[model samples]
Each structure stands twice: as structure tokens, then as C-alpha cells.
Target: MKIAVTSKAFAKNETLKSELQSFFPDCRFNTSGRLLNESELIEFLGDCDGAIVAMEQIQAPVLDDVNLLKVIAKFGVGLNNIDLSYCQKNGIPVKWTAGINRQSVAEMALGFMLMLIRNLYTTSNQLKKGEWNKSGGQSLYGKTIGIIGMGHIGQELTHLLKPFACRVLANDVVDINEFCEKNGVVSVGKETIYAEADIISLHTPLNTSTVQFIDATAFHKMTKKPIFINTARGELVNLQDLHDALLNGQLYGAAIDVYDVEPPTHKELISMPNLVCTPHIGGNSAEATLAMGRSAISHLVDSLLGAANER
Candidate 1:
């Protein structure tokens, strides 16, 4: 079996290369960075059984080009970057690495929440300009926090928030009754969570229904001015709604780590002062990167080594 790795723009693929070698010794591995066209990716993935991928588009267009492609062991849980339904329909399994970087993502969420509430970014800029203003920060100890998705990352975030003694409200599609009970968090509907939470953090994935899940109407529904935070998919929150919320006093502030676009080719939402933006580095921590890489590669070997099993 030949294993080909399509590299990310600024990501390190060393661990993925080593892990693939460990599983299939006879497999040929080639690392590439410039796959501008679908034909180019097809040429690289020529006879490969499975490929470890990150943030690359594996649509039917690129998928059509590859002949022996079987498994796409994506390095993370989010499948928004790929055409997952098309892959599923064509029997090309898109295996994901889950529960590997939960702690990293949870910690980043906590940091952003605290930063937004305290206005840390603004304070730093003010000090740099030689201004002395003693601003007060709100307490998270007794405030309410709404977590959008109560998955592994959401549960992990609750663990970190517990030290702050926050009342946690969780919203998810499935029955999280037992999960919420064990974690000292209460499960509620999405509308109720949006209306009552002092701080709202998103832990959901990007899907058709969830895209723009928190739009203008959702922002308008938030009764209390919230310290909004989104560490999940960026498309979940409509940028204009958020901008209006900030402009019209509907929101206190926001901390964003992800965007609808990667590397941000667009310029509308990111330039806002109230929103603290990072370079989508939520899962780029040293430990998290290695864990995701190792876990994804392991899944690839399990499903794709023998005969390029689709699932």
C-alpha cells in the first residue's frame, strides 16, 4: 500500500509521516505542499491506499481524480473542509480523530472567555499607548455559562469552568441527561441557553443545519449582554449579526479563534475591535498537534492497510 500525505500551508507533517511508516512498512510515502488543482492531488494520490489530511478540500472533484484512494484519515474531528456527504455516498470513509485534543480546545475556550470578560486585549493596547485606566472585570464565579454542544470538548470545558463555580447550561441534540448530571451541568434547549447565559461558548461542529446557527435572530434573542466566545466552526455565528450586536449594545465583547474562511481571505468581521481574533490556532498546541496526528494515522492503518476498506 502506498501512503501519500497532503501537507497544510504552515503545519508540520513529520509526525504523520513517521506514524504512517510504523503501520505500513512497505507503503510508499510522499509529502506535498502545492496541490493547486484537483488533477495535481490526483497525481500525488495515484496508487495510495489511505492519506493523512489536514484542512484540504477532498470534494468529489478531487476524490474523482484519485483511483485507489480508500480512507481519508482527517487529522481533526471537523469535516467542514471536506465534502463528507459526497465521500460517504461514494463509500470513501472519512475517518476522524476524536477525543484527542479535547483538553487543548477546552483550555483555549476558557482563556478566550476570561480575556473577553476582562478586556485583556484592549487593556494591553491602552497601556501601550500610555493610558492609565483602572477597569473592572466581571466575575465568572457565580455567572451563567451556556455551552452549545456537550460533546467531549464541551464536557472538558465544564471541568475547567468548575473552578470558577459557574452555573453551566448545555444544549445539544442528543440526550445528555446522564452526561450533564455527572458533570454538574444542566442541559437546556438552544433558545433558552441563548437568552439566559451571561457568557456563551460554542463547542459544536460545522454542518448544514448548524451553519449560521447563531445569526441575527439568535443574537437578538440574547436578552443579556453576553461575553460571546466561539472556538468551534466560524460559520456558526453570522458576522454581521455579531457586528450589529456589538454596535447596538447587544453584546459586551467577543473572542473568536475560528473563522468561516481559512487564512481569512475576506476582510469584514476580523477587523472589528471588540472581537479578539487568533490565527485559528485552537488545536495547534504542541501536545494536541502530536496527539491528533498520531490518532489520525492510527485510524488510517486500522481501516486502510489490508485492502483499502472504505470505512
Candidate 2:
């Protein structure tokens, strides 16, 4: 079977490449070192029987053009990029495993909280610029931490925070009262979390309701002026509001792992002294990358090859 791997990072991994080849030698990998556009993606996926993809949008148009494509296995957790309704309508199988890199992202969120609270990021940058400032920020111990989503990554982060003895206030659309009770978390409304917490972290998925969820209004409700962190989807927060919040002292600090635009060009926002940013590497840890790649490959193998063998 002809297979296409659209994730540039996963394509370049020799370990994953060899493992995939053992199952299906007729595989194509995107070695362009960048994300492919629609035309490029169509050409790359042409006539392939199965595919393992990451971040690339696979809507109805792409699916229509790539008629030979049978099954798709996702390399990461987010499904906002894929048109699930279209895939289901066409009887195409999309295999995806959530929380495959839960620990990696959870760790990064915790790191962001520590960095912002302790003023590690700002101090490090100041030192690099030949400025001496000895402002050691506050500790994470016994602080009120507000977690906006109680999904896989959020749950993992809750577990990680146990050692710090933090007061965790959680908010979710679904019923998580049982989990909150068991974990000593206070399941409260988002507004209560916004008003009371010392630190706020977002882990919700991007959907219609959650798009631009954190705006000026949300920031205004943050009475404690807590440090804010977003390791989840970028579209969930308004970048302009975030920038304004930091500039106007509405927030203590902010840390961003993802952005509305990858390689974000908002110089003013990125250059803020009270903010720390990464190139969306929360789930790209060495261990997480390998695990995510293997899971995708396994899903494709099981769907395409293992099923045929069973038949």
C-alpha cells in the first residue's frame, strides 16, 4: 500500500521511518522541512492508500482530490484541523489517540507557571542584555492555581501540582465534580477562577464556543492579576487583549507555547518584558515526538494491514 506521512518532523525521524518501512515500504515522507500548502499536500498524497498526518487541514476538497486515500491516522491530539463530519460521511476512518503527549504538555505548563511566578524568564533575558536585576519572584507553593480545562493534559498537570500543595480551582463544560472531589480540586465556574486564582492556565480545545474565550472581559475579571499561561490552542485567546493586559498591568505575566499564527509576527506582543514565549514545542519533546509518531504508524498499520491480514 502507498502511504503518505505529512508531518515534516515525523518524516525526518529515521527511527520512525525504519519502523514504518518495515510494515509498508511504499511510503512517502514530506522532507520539505515546512508545512505543505494545499497543492503541495495534494501532490504529496496523490494515490496513497493511507496517511499519517499532523496539523495539515484535510477537508472535503482535499479528500475529494485524493480519492485513493483510505484511512488517516493523526500524529497529534487536536482534531480542529480535520473535517470529521466529512470523513464520517465518506466512510473514511480517522484514528486518533488523545493525551498521547499529555505529560510533555503538562510539564511545559507547570514550567511556564514556575518561570512566570519566579521571574526566571525576564531576569534571564535582562542578564543577557548586560542589566543586573535581582528580583526573585514568588514561589509556586500554596498558590491558588486555576485550570480552565480538566481534560487529559489538565488532569496530568493537576497531578503534577500535588507536590506544590497548590489550591487548584478547575472549570470545565462537562461534569467533573467527581474527579475534582477525588483530586481535592474545587470545581467552580470560570468567572470564579478568573477572580480568585493566583495563576491561570488554559487547556481547553478550540471550538466555536471556546474561540477567543479569553478576551478583554476575561482579563478584566482577573482581580488577582495572576500569571496567565496558554499551552493549548492559540485561537482560544485574543492576542491583542493578552498584549494589552500585560502592557497595562492587568496581568502579572504571561507565557505562550502556541499562537494564533505559528511564527507569530506580532513584535510588540512577543517583545513584552512580562511575557515569555516558545515556538509551540510543548508536545514536541523527544520522548513525546517518538511516542506520537509510533502511535500514528501503529494506527495506520492496524487499520490498513492488520485488518487485511485478519480478513
lDDT of each model, Cα atoms only? 0.79, 0.93
lDDT of 2 by residue, 1-311 (tens): 99999998898899999999999999899998887888887888888999999988888778878888889999989999888999999989999899999999999999999998998988999999999989999999999999999999999999999999999999999999999999999999999999999999999999999999999999999999999999999899999999999999999999998889887878899999999899989999999999999999999988999989999
Worst 10 residues of 2 by lDDT: 55-64
What TM-score, computed on C-alpha atoms, does each candidate reach?
Answer: 0.89, 0.98
Q: CA shift at 284, candidate 2, in angstroms?
A: 0.9
Off by over 4 Å in 2: none
Give candidate 1 regions above 4 Å deviation.
9-15, 22-39, 265-268, 306-311
lDDT of 1: 0.79
- Superposed Cα deviation of residue 93, candidate 2 (Å): 0.8
Candidate 1 similarity to native, TM-score: 0.89
Clashing pairs in 1: none
